[model samples]
Target: MPVTVHFAAGPAAWREYHDHLPRALADAGVQAEILLTAPDPAAVDYIVFAPSGEIQDFSPYVNCKAVLNLWAGVERIIGNTTLTQPLARMVDPAMTESMVEWVVGHTLRHHLGMDLHILNQDGVWRNEITPPIARERPVAVLGLGALGRAAGEALAALNFPVMGWSRTPKNISGIDCHSGDAGLAAVLSRAEIVILLVPLTAGTENLMNAERLARLPKGAVILNPGRGPLIDDAALLAALDRGHLGHATLDVFRNEPLPKGHPFWTHPRVTVTPHIAASTRPLTASAVVAENIRRGEAGEPLLYLVDRARGY
Candidate 1:
């Protein structure tokens, strides 16, 4: 029998994946029936899901082999008590490439003080302030996950000294890896520009609180393309207000479409991007989904499986 793959990632996603997914499944040699609505949930062999999807109860899909997430971050649905099936997170190459490009572009923007010239269009020549080259700038990446490692390596290639810290120790070829509380502090202290790409979890919520934010070298810039609650808003505003930190370029936030009254929107030192750092391109993302479905049928190990204990 062909596999019954239910596309439960929502209407917008359905529109994006409807065409690409079938082609990808064909390429992977998987015979699957893609369903937008499963009248008999128990018959579903797999589920392609997203946090915004309609299906909140996984108990109905008794025969489902695995739940394949459409996005990289799984914090939204990870704690669902009803979700018993094995889960896998998306790790699309196109998404990673987009993240690296955004990180590198902003890192260089802050490093070169492009804002100083761009914002100050007053006919005055600002050649007096010459920024140091990439080699002289020290950068730290707070997460060593796929996206983090990719961004760190890209910066490393540009001669920026890259230090990476993770929940546990990692040994990426180009990154100077660190782990544990002590390691985080060590990396934060020396970094002139710090990038936040850590996942959101109870232990990591408010990871950049006032105390930790203070550990950064004075005039340090922060690039947060990761989770929003990772940084404390009040503390960040305070740091920027006091001019202790150089600037913050934030792509994610605690409240997306950040409230009109929120200080971050008006804060001179803060750059608010509409969570556009990276996105799952349908063509590439569908292939990842297709590959996993193929593996599930072949009884091979599924790629990017999520460990519930780790809450990634």
Candidate 2:
């Protein structure tokens, strides 16, 4: 009998994410059953879950293979007491590529002052505007994990003098990596563009506070594709107000809707996007999920597994 798989993130997921994923799963010879609501845990073989979904009682699934997460960040579900089963987080290559493209494009856009050239209809040749070289412009990526590392590598490849700071020190092949207080300072001191890509862990909460914000180079650009809580909104706004930051391009936020009345919408230097930087395209995501399931059945280490102790 084919292994049963169920997606318990509801019907909207069928349209938004799972539409193309089933085909990828079929290629891997995995029979996935996508349940709109939580099913009998006994009959469930594999579960493709979202943190925002309705599956609360994981203790019932005695024969479950793995709880494969649909979203990358699993902070909301990591603390569930009944979920003792091994959890694997999503890490799709398509998603990674998309994120790299977005971050790189935006960095270049700001670095080159592309907007100014587009707005100039005067037809007068502005020859005095020579953009700064990437090597001299320091960029600090706050998280050194998978997505952050890839973004940092892309920036470093462009010779932007990339510095990656994570919760722990990570030694990358070609990047200047740093961690903790000293590392943070070193990176921020030289960084003309600062990107926040860390998760919303307790230790990382309000990571970009007033003191940290002040440490950055004056008139630095800010790009946040990570959790909203990683930055203190008040501190960021104040920095921008004081001309410490040139611009802020933010994708994710503390609230999903980002209320119509929020100051970010009207802030001249703030560019708000509805979290489109690192979306998990399920065609690639399903392949990752299926591979992990195959590894689970084969008694091998699952790929992209979340470490509960570290709260990642």
TM-score for each of the candidates: 0.99, 0.94
Superposed Cα deviation of residue 116, candidate 2 (Å): 2.4
Please list the C-alpha lDDT of all candidates, in the order they appear: 0.96, 0.85
Q: Which stretches of candidate 1 lie over 4 Å from their true place?
A: none
The TM-score obtained by model 2 is 0.94
- Worst ten-residue run, lDDT, model 2? 30-39
Task: Mark the regions of model 2 whose C-alpha exceeds 4 Å error after superposition.
Answer: 16-19, 31-39, 120-127
- Give one digit per residue, the lDDT tens place, for model 2 in 134-194: 9878898999888999999999999988989988878997788999889998889889999
Error of 1 at 116 (Å): 1.1
Best by lDDT: 1
How far off is residue 53 in model 1, in Å?
0.5
Flag clash pairs in model 2. 5-33, 6-33, 7-34, 7-35
lDDT of 1 by residue, 180-251 (tens): 999999999999999999999999999999999999999999999999999999999999999999999999
Clashing pairs in 1: none
